[model samples]
Target: MGIRLMALALIPMLPHLPFGQSSLSTSPLGIGTVKWGRTEGLKHAPFSLPDDATLHQLLDAAEAAGINVLDSAPAYGLAESRLGSLLASRPNRFHVFTKAGESFSHGASFWDFSESAIRRSVENSLRLLRTDRLDAVTLHCPRHDLSVLSQSDAPAVLSSLKSEGKILLSGFSVMSLDAGLLAVPHFDYLMVAWNPGFLEHQPVIEAAALARKGILLKKVLSSGSFTSVSPAESLRAARNLPGNPVILAGTINPHHLRDNIAALT
Candidate 1:
């Protein structure tokens, strides 16, 4: 659903705007591609990766629907490679946001924030995403340990990539307010979880908004269960959480994608 610019208090990321109209601007909506490539590897996954035809149709739908950002990571099976290949045809269609630090092997996670590790991760992402540059690179750190990310050379590594014009935004996908606050000073964007049932990081999101950093919301639809909540209701609850947030809805179903685009405005 389209996001409105009304009463969006605390942070006027986008000040006054009308309701029922989706903004064509770049900040409000994004697609998370975890299920786009493979579903068997992640927790709570309910679908398998799509074939080429389905993925092509999905991208077509995204383009027709005016969706702008596509979020993916190396940990998301073949998501990066698929995107790299598929998106080459529509290079300017959507912005790409991916991550480093946390990786997967045998469906298990491994974390490394050392300078070299970060560098290798970024380089690999560049190759896999089929781009010399990335829109944003997040430190995929665990929530509880997020506050200590600065101890690693991650910020420096991302900064170097930014300096080389390879990254537009640098950030972290954090799990706690303390970690979110710590990330505010160092990142351009912060990915946090905010849904109807979870509000523990509301303050952290507000803090991020106060700092003028962009916020990307994960699990907005409650892992697609949305429980008994309708998309509009779920989106409303998300708006009530905190921050001038951006929704990252991961879906392979075209109808859901359309519904997701229309729920909030």
Candidate 2:
């Protein structure tokens, strides 16, 4: 058979093998809290607060189902606060990853990628999460000015935080390969969206693997286009990748979270 046809035939069996599974082998699948405590009145959704009771239930469900990594951001309004309150008394095994760059305003959000902004955002995340430090803090997308992150200065800042024991890992989220490759050497992890509809990122995934950087797969559900592939299929595809370890799917529903966990199992 031709090489192209041979590779195509292997696609169906990719998920059955163990490839990207090791990255997450030590960590449970992640849950993104973007919608938690989010309101719709802002540019995207403003003045929104997720119901505390509902959020608590969701956290409980996630924990019960063995999800240990929870990702949030300051731009996510009250999400960090809610997560902090919910998991405060729980065990410390849960990994919380947050982002810097954007802040919430009156019915809108704005980006602030200045050094001051990065410092303040990390401080705020520590305060809101009720923790002394964070497990991971990503760049949370490219800056509004589109200025590339300075490798020398950026690493210094994140290294300073590491020295202070405030953050365990520093990474960035990028929509394009150029940004991803730019941040790779400076950061420890890279969160990128990878789904069938957005296969443009396949090369990025391969590059990250070659770089030995940890890869966090986001938007695996393609923003509710679950009909294209099941969660198991998504997990399988991620596992087949060279270095992808964790895949995060956002959902406020406990049942959906459980279903996602089932796919990994």
Error of 1 at 81 (Å): 0.1
Best by lDDT: 1
Query: Where is model 2 more than 4 Å wrong at Cα?
Result: 1-28, 41-50, 143-146, 150-155
Q: The CA-based lDDT of model 2 is what?
A: 0.69
Model 1 ranges with Cα > 4 A deviation: 1-27, 147-150, 239-243
What value of lDDT does candidate 1 attain over all alpha carbons?
A: 0.73
Please write out the lDDT profile of model 1 over residues 1-265, one tens digit for every residue. Answer: 3332221121212222211112223546578898886666555556667787777766766665566678898788889999999998897788788999888878688888888898899889999988888878888876555544757788888888889888777878987677777777777878888777777877768887777677788887778675767777877676655455777877888667656656654
Backbone clash total, candidate 1: 5
* Error of model 2, residue 168, in angstroms: 1.0
For candidate 1, which ten residues in a row score worst on lDDT?
Answer: 12-21
- RMSD to the true structure for each prediction, in A, is 7.1, 9.5
What count of clashes does model 2 give?
10
Count of clashes, each model: 5, 10
